[model samples]
Target chain A: MRAEALLLFFSFSIGIVTGDWNILSYTTKKRDHHQHHAGISLKNYCESWRINVELNNIRGFDVVPGECVGYIGKYMTSTQYKVDVQRAAEQTTLFLTNNFRLGADGKDAWIFDIDDTLLSTVPYFKKHQHGAVLGCRGATTNSTSMEQWMEERSAPAVEHMLDLYHEIRARGLKIFLISSRREHLRDATIDNLVKVGYLGWTDLILRCAEDCYHAVANYKTEKRRKLIEQGYHLWGIMGDQWCSLVGHPSANRTFKLPNPMKKAL
Target chain B: MRAEALLLFFSFSIGIVTGDWNILSYTTKKRDHHQHHAGISLKNYCESWRINVELNNIRGFDVVPGECVGYIGKYMTSTQYKVDVQRAAEQTTLFLTNNFRLGADGKDAWIFDIDDTLLSTVPYFKKHQHGAVLGCRGATTNSTSMEQWMEERSAPAVEHMLDLYHEIRARGLKIFLISSRREHLRDATIDNLVKVGYLGWTDLILRCAEDCYHAVANYKTEKRRKLIEQGYHLWGIMGDQWCSLVGHPSANRTFKLPNPMKKAL
Candidate 1:
């Protein structure tokens, strides 16, 4: 009976060890998906619901050569609106610069996402109540002034946050802005980032025309890998979507701030 | 006074936010280093403190084309002796298989460090008195029974963890065993992994004589990039040292188990 008890005790110990392993593994797997998505993408994904950009015909918008304007509409145009696109952009910048280690080590870099992250072009479609507003005949072609639109459609950067960005550049970190805005929106997006006090960056990376075929995360990862290969240790990354941080381990220590206009995306 | 109160509140909030970001970034950075070194080179680095292998002279040893053995002395060797190496190997395996989503869906793969991770050759070293006996003039020159020299040198799979691997493989996940072990030791290491139930991996990446210049983490990252180019998403990675997981984001999620033999390099 003693011998049997010893054997039983050993077996029970093994069972406990193995059981712990399985539980830990399951918990970890669940956490991987959770952490990868976090809450950052939830708001963005919901906002995407209002965006009816044809996944296949993203190019038809004449994004290049044609001037584009961003508008924040005060309407519930889609079932997926979670945050107002304008407020989301302000909160993203404030949260990232204030919370992350930006402009450190004299290596200036900034990673940004296009779409609702940087511009609120979603308004053009909502005003027309459709996804293909730009492609529609007779759509207004003249782009609105970014400064005026920012004041009218979005909240300006909080005073302290703008000051913080100035402080970042004063430290000598060369800033690089990365985005998935597509090559066509490059000129307008750069103009917007500059008008909004993001003029310190050294370079801006926009998504190539071919990037439409890849997942947003994959595109961001490849861009980040290229940046690292070019010998830059990015100090900060900001995006309204989790996809922006996919390949950036250096900037994984991120910050998420509340988007006050949580219903108008 | 009202202005002062508001200023104070904002300052306090900014302080808290900045402090939290710093702590998170530091913790993740440290974890990155830990995950980078959790493999064969970690063991080799530890071993280097005792035996220096001249990379240039490794070819000289290859000229003999026979069995080579290294023996480590008693448990109490020097101040560098650590009792945690053995425990770390077991724990690392458990942590890796549990936390990372490692299944085929072509979404992830693992690069394992061989030596201490999959096999404990320290027992053989101890039996041979830290390679002193084996290093003696005119040691056996042909293939010797690795299992026979030291009974403890046998590579034993962490039993409960096999299910995790089987699960990974069943889901189509690829596994690669990377080692800094000499090219001559390849067959022995492979045989050990097979005997210990770690057979049927996607690839076994080893350090060639010409590939010694780069740090282990750099080497692993380059290899991982190639795998990624091949369309594999690296969701999980494991190593016993800081250099093995350097370039991958998953390295931040590495687990460090207790090392039973804390040999230092």
Candidate 2:
């Protein structure tokens, strides 16, 4: 209540203050622990930044901010990250069970983005400074290293997603695994999926030669468009990237899993 | 490091474990205080839910989850929320000062949402159980109460947005305040804006009889469409709701301020 009062006080004060307006100073004032409230600490601020990133308000970033490396590291490895993923899975499954009605034609399908959505790439990210090096796009040493990492065929399945995969199959929904990973990695990717217990899926779609130059959103949209043309009803599309779920010809519902470590546009 | 290893261990273990899969159990395992991780507490889960909300992943929530009332309360009144707003404003200012070029024509305009974006209706929300009642759309006793609250003309300016408004004005770009508030409240709304130091803006567009039944997004989109028809170049649109920024004929950029109190879609 006191904090609310202080905020209101500050709000009116800023309105009345005559000089050069510095709005941040009023809200960010550091109160002592002995006083009513502590100010916004670096950890608190980074959490806010992460919220912004997840909100898709902050985009087209190559890497996490320099100061937020430790925060991001802790967040990725923390129980919070696990809980977030579980909640996303829960929501998707809840929507599927309660609202979605599969047609008799067997044309009902669900799109799953492979990396971060269906597979755990956090181990590789942990080794690479939690998105500092390997989270970016395009041809560089980072991309080459990422390719080698994919080639190892050792990435684990995203925890709840494997179960969700089985649930989708059991419900007779055709599972289409769409990934931004290039076509050349398809063999290794399949091996990785099989090893990780994603034994059967309708199709594993990867970026081919025709998709090389397009943005991730455009490429994914094209894939969905093709599915639409093929007489498939996309029931749900799940991914860690907004690009996976956005664009025209969207699914009946889209679920976004949390991945603060990387953003692809 | 231990957490990361434990997560990896769980990731692989889930794949190998054969029976009926309850995957959430694997990741959400609660450890002792003496052990490596404490697992996800209730507080942690609510935080994740909040993240999901901000991500636009969770939508159409009627009220803050009953268990999350306290968490949302602390978050709203905390320094963290203020810092989030500040960071949003900072990002907007950075984009404006660095990337945005004002045209010689007066048509280069910016759009601002009224409630939550320009003013703080938190006081009324606090009285109404932090959006338990008033956040819903349509005519009800809650709407009447909310109308009375607005008529008081006592709402405070959202801390950083007023400054952003001034900065936008100083840059010679036309400013349009487009709100979902009915036209009946225009006088009080204008009074509130003036009382809180938002002295000048190009126009204040409010909903009228024709817009009574339209979804907020559609209404705001129509306004933008009309602006475009009038040769307005919407360089930027800033709002607390996604509805304000989305839809056809979008601006060059859209900035979303953090607001967890209410969702109108």
Please compute DockQ, using alpha carbons, for every candidate against the native two-chain complex. 0.02, 0.18
CA lDDT, candidate 1, residue B71:
13
Candidate 2 deviant stretches above 4 angstroms: A1-40, A132-140, B1-40, B132-141
lDDT of 1 by residue, B1-265 (tens): 4324433543343334321110011111112332312221222222222121210101112221111121123222211122123223333444555555545466566666654445545555444433322121112342154334433336554322344455556656677776655456567667767776676798888665765555555666777777777877765565433344445534324332212222211
Tens digits of lDDT, candidate 2, B69-179: 656765666556765776687678777887778777778899998888889887887787776343324334467788889999999877667667888888888999998
Give the CA lDDT, 0 to 100, for residue A143 in model 2.
78
Maximum-TM-score candidate: 2
lDDT scores in order: 0.40, 0.72
Docking class of 1: incorrect
* Leading candidate by lDDT: 2
Tally clashing residue pairs in candidate 1: 44
Q: Which model scores highest in DockQ?
A: 2
Mind sharing the TM-score for model 2?
0.81
